[model samples]
Target: MSKKSRPGSRSRALVAATAVVVTLLTGAVGAGAAPATTAQRARPTVILVHGALTDASVWRHEVEALQRKGYAVLAPAMPLRGLASDSAYLAAFLKTVSGPIVLAGHSYAGAVITRAAEGDPRVRALVYVTAFQPDTGETAGELNARFPGSRLGPDTTVVLEHPGGSELYLRQQDFRDVYAGDLSPSTAALMAATQRPVETAALGEPLQGRPAWRDTPSWALVATKDNSLPVATQRFMTARAHSRTTEVASSHAAPVSHPAEVTGLLLDAIRGTAY
Candidate 1:
């Protein structure tokens, strides 16, 4: 009886060992394949394109906020040259991104994304942050004039002739009033001092090809107190593009003055498009 029991115990031990080996192999395969499956389902990258008169630093807060939620974020410096040239540059940059994208633009960059995202399938959605949404064959300057509330006239800006072309800058004295009325005076002064100027011709250059907003789903953040591009103009453009609109009591520099609200709007666009 003891010998028979011993044989049965050995058989059970062998079976248990085989089962453990199979389980380990299965887990190894699962561990290796899980990341690829998860990667395929990962959230889309968020590219925040800063508008003219400001560099990518304008998206600093949004970048930080988005990163906290595990989203990959990039804020590229725009050439701010001409519409065609800048759009070409942005389109080229989009090529470097590897997965689905939630493309966002602030102020003048909206016009750039409008054209740059054309024909690119990776850009899942467009988020306009108090941005310019020009139509095909339309120019930023033209859109600025569609409404009467804008204060971004010659009075609030300065023009300088560079070797290549003239660049436009927000005047430090009036930057707070025109672009960042919702911000503190000190912060506005710092922003004015560091603001990057856009080429004068960029504002007047017509967006060459079809506007991406015409094809892609879009979201717009309207800064109700914005003085640069008037809220009315923002509403008109977003409405024409059929964009989901969110209004906040912010200035033209919504990204800087209201980063959390801007982040929320961007997240909305991401969730809406990142199926």
Candidate 2:
């Protein structure tokens, strides 16, 4: 009987070579394929604007905290002149940022941001910290006058015909008691000495457009023990603006005295706007 036909050594070698070539060809195709490009992550920029009688320094703690958490934070020095001019200035500044923004305002800045953010689709959220949330045709002064508990009237000093309009300052003697009751006396003194004055006209300027909060999501921090802007007044304004609100037992300088709480509120705003 003829020997059973079997694969010859040459045929076996050819089969092995083909398998190696196939494996190498498969690997080469995979290696040459383009890697999936990860979509660039988007993060909203946070802009913190200070109110009357204070500069951007007030947001130091908040800035530090937010930065540590990987947020892009900016505390712009707002020209605390008349509302129209300041809002225009801020609006111009806003135009320079490339992405969505979470705008935060303290005291008079709330009104400024309200005006600045109007008609701007990039502002995703508004945060009012012991701030004035004025409606159209309403002034910060009007909002402050709506309630009677504020102790700021007597503590303020006015200078007419100053450079940027009628300037207003907090009396150094009353700064601690009226604006920063929860802060250390030394720190409060330094704050009083370095506080930036606001033009009186800014407080009286009536808002020209519907507040951004009317259409944007909003968060408000009510300083319960505030002596500058009455807590009740803060509540009323926030309620009118339909803001998500939280109250802390703090003075008007809540951002300075209870920074953690203030920072917490701001982070909440950031999270609310994130997809």
Candidate 3:
């Protein structure tokens, strides 16, 4: 994970969806049909999934925080091009986790986790941090169209704000008012310089089956000041999926703004859903 002043979303790409038997970090969430005793035991494996255009590095702080709290975590790298590619990758990853598992994702990756959760019984819970939690048979594109005035994504090819800005790409100074209103000028500039460009096709693809969230105990972190994915859209998705909710006054980049809070929620989900 890059240090402070790093640009863009640092996300570990979700490679595949295989059931992975993992060890618990704090609570007794391991091996079986949901656990009978629900006291804090050991931290289970924490799998972090990244959104489009970004890589696995976005989860740096949360990953470290989870580990410090005692979780054997894994954040898979994903194929940013489309949902099917990411889903297949996640499916393969979960199959190997032997015990209770907490699968989490941000932004577009939320849909990826949703698609992979079905049929795979190993996944104990989910965390959607400012992400898109898709419903049964609905495509990401369909959800984008739901807002009427506000689509889930931007149409133009997300371009780089500067020539030498690494991979960070977004509208100039937009985060100031929308996503990262609380951030300083320097911080916002850093995010802009490192922003990754999400593949255009990733947004339009829809879910083909039931979302994994329906059966899984789910938690969501909504960025109230987001400019990228509308806050209303996130609310709609959460309500439609019937997930446990938490709100933060950040931007679309909640992990970046509030890594501590994100990690804490993830821990709670893993411990509570420990089986």
Candidate 4:
């Protein structure tokens, strides 16, 4: 070589080259990561909370439908122990999720979310699918009796007592007429046999805090033929909440019997809450 390079100069040259490569790679990664993050923030997560006498399985159709549409959905199992405790549990669960949420509750799950979503800014909207939307100091039992035609009563439910508290299940014989009138008898029978029992105290437990529907935008599905919660009661509750409402001639088990309708209403809520 005409001029031999110094070791120091050679080392510096190598480091400079490495820095340039790293900068280029970092810039490429940053560019790719930005869009992914934006997409995640753009869509709100849909959290479906099932009510008493059922579990997350009730949202099977909805979960699949929404997933096919590229939406993130979760149907968490409600404790169904009592209003205060169940709401507390849901509120805790909500804290673990990131970004925004569109919370939907069915039947008694409505009251759960009504209290669970309180003061949570992440909950952008509330969807009540033939569910209770009890205000502060209101109980589910009280709301059920606010209107006539609810077939759910002592006659239709079987009570079981335990050390903790009593639980109630829809009698297998009356389950079809009371809960899943729109579903086939076979399907209703399976539901009846597999239905979960709810703590009887949950019905009388009042919603302790401010209902989320009071502040959040709300959508409701009024099952006109609902035997567990009458159509008139659904209308009254949704009206009080000033909810954007849809009416379907389904039973209390709208998600099971009218899955498409339930999915459509949930999509409306998702689109509505999207930023």
Per-residue lDDT for 162-268 in model 1, tens only?
78889998888999999999999999999999999889988999888889998999999999998889889999999999999999999998999889999999989
Put down candidate 3 lDDT per residue, 1-275, tens digits, no spaces: 96664333323222221112222422344434245343334346779998864568779899888787767888887866678877888888888776667889998899999998887767888999989888766776566556653322344234444443322234655644444556678877676666666656567777878888888889999877776677788889888777888888877778878898898789778767856
Task: Write the residue-wise lDDT of candidate 4 on 133-162 in tens digits.
Answer: 998899999999988999988899999999
Name the runs in model 4 displaced over 4 angstroms: 1-41
Q: Per-candidate TM vs. native? A: 0.87, 0.84, 0.74, 0.86
- Score each candidate by Cα lDDT: 0.91, 0.88, 0.74, 0.93
Which scores greater on lDDT, model 2 or model 4? 4
As a whole number from 0 to 100, the lDDT of residue 210 in candidate 1 is 84
Query: Backbone clashes per model, in order?
Result: 0, 0, 62, 0
Candidate 2 accuracy as TM-score: 0.84
Report the number of the highest-lDDT candidate.
4
lDDT of 1 at 100: 90
What lDDT, from 0 to 1, does candidate 3 have? 0.74
RMSD of each: 4.0, 5.8, 19.9, 6.1
In model 4, the clashing pairs are none
For model 2, residues 1-275, the per-residue Cα lDDT tens digits are 87765679779889999999999999887776633211123678999999888899999999999999999999999888799999999999999997789999999999999999998998989999999888889998888888887777843664657554578888989898889999999999999999898888788889997779899999999999988899889988888888999999999888899999999998898888852
Worst 10 residues of 4 by lDDT: 266-275
